[model samples]
Target: MQIILGRLDTHLGRPRQAQQRLRAAYDGGQPPAEYWAAVGARLGIAVDDPLAERLTAADIAGWLHPDPAALDLLDELRSAPVQLALLSNAPAVFGRAAERQDWTRGFQHLLFSGDVQLIKPDPRIYRLLLDRIGARAAECLFFDDRPDNVRAAQECGMRAELWRGAPAARSGLRERGAITP
Candidate 1:
C-alpha cells in the first residue's frame, strides 16, 4: 500500500498530499474512478491515464484477504446464538470486493467506512452500526485491532474488546458466554 501511495505521490509530483487525498476520498465513500478523477483534477492530468488505472487496480488487489483462522472461527459462530456483523474501516472498493468472498457470507451485516463515510473512533459510526444491525449498543460485542476504535465502541456502550487474534477472540467469546466451551 505504501508503495502504491509512493508511486501515486511521484506521479502527482506531490510528496504526500496525493496519497492523503486518495485515502480521504476513498474513506469518504468515493468510488475508484471518482477517487482517481479527484486526484487527476488536482494534478491537472487526464483521469483516463493508464497509470491511474494501474494504481487503482493495484490498490484494490492489495486491499485485504480473509484470514483462514478467523474464517474457521466465524464458521463456529454461525450456529451460535448470536448475530454476526462486520464493521470495517476500508475503502468502498475493498468493501465491494469483500462482499464477493465466501467468508463474508457468514456476516449478517457488513459496514464499511467508505460505504458509509464514517471511519472508526467516531461515535457516530458505532451508532450507525447498532442501527443498521437493529441492536442496542449494549447488545453488541465489538472487536477491533485498534485501541482507539475499541475505546470508541466502549464509549458507545458496547462490550468492545481489542482483537489479539483468533485464539484470543475465541477465549474472549467463551469468557463472555457468547460461545460454548
Candidate 2:
C-alpha cells in the first residue's frame, strides 16, 4: 500500500490552522493571507490575481504541535511494505517546519502543492505523485482532512480517506491492513 498525505497529518510540526494563526499575528488580524499579502506586499501567486492574498513560511516558525498518536501511526506504517509520500499545500518553509520536528521521519518522499504550484482537488497533482513513485492509482491511498480532496483522489482512482482526525483514522487504517502493532 502507498500512502499519499497532507503535511499537517504527517507531522508534529506547524499544523494547518496553527500556521494560519501564526500568519495572522503579522497581518492586521483580517485573515493572515490577505493581511500579510498586503502588509508585506507579497505578490499573489498569479499575475492575474495580483490582489490575491497568501501565507508565507516566515509566518509559521514554531506554532505546530504533533498529535500524540502520529508517531504510533508512522511506526506502524513503517512495519509494512508501504511507500509514504507527502502531498501538501505548502512551500519549502513547510518542509522546514517538519524538519524542526524530531518525530518527522520515515516518509519516502514529499510533493507539496506550493512546490508544484498546484493545490489538491487538482488531478494533475495526484498524477505527479503517482508518476514519481511509479505507483498506480489502483494501488494507492490518499488521506486528507478535506472531503473535496478525498473526492478528487477517488475520481483519479486512488482510494481516499477523509481525515476527521485521530482514533477514527487509526481504526480505519488498521482495518485497511496498513497498520498493525
Q: Model 2: how far is 39 from its true place, Å?
A: 6.2
**Count of clashes, each model:** 0, 1
Best by lDDT: 1
| Model 2 clash tally, residue pairs | 1
Candidate 2 segments exceeding 4 Å error: 1-35, 39-58
Among these predictions, the greatest TM-score belongs to 1
Model 1 weakest 10-residue run by lDDT? 1-10
RMSD of each: 4.0, 11.0
Note the Cα lDDT for every prediction shown.
Answer: 0.82, 0.63
TM per model? 0.79, 0.66
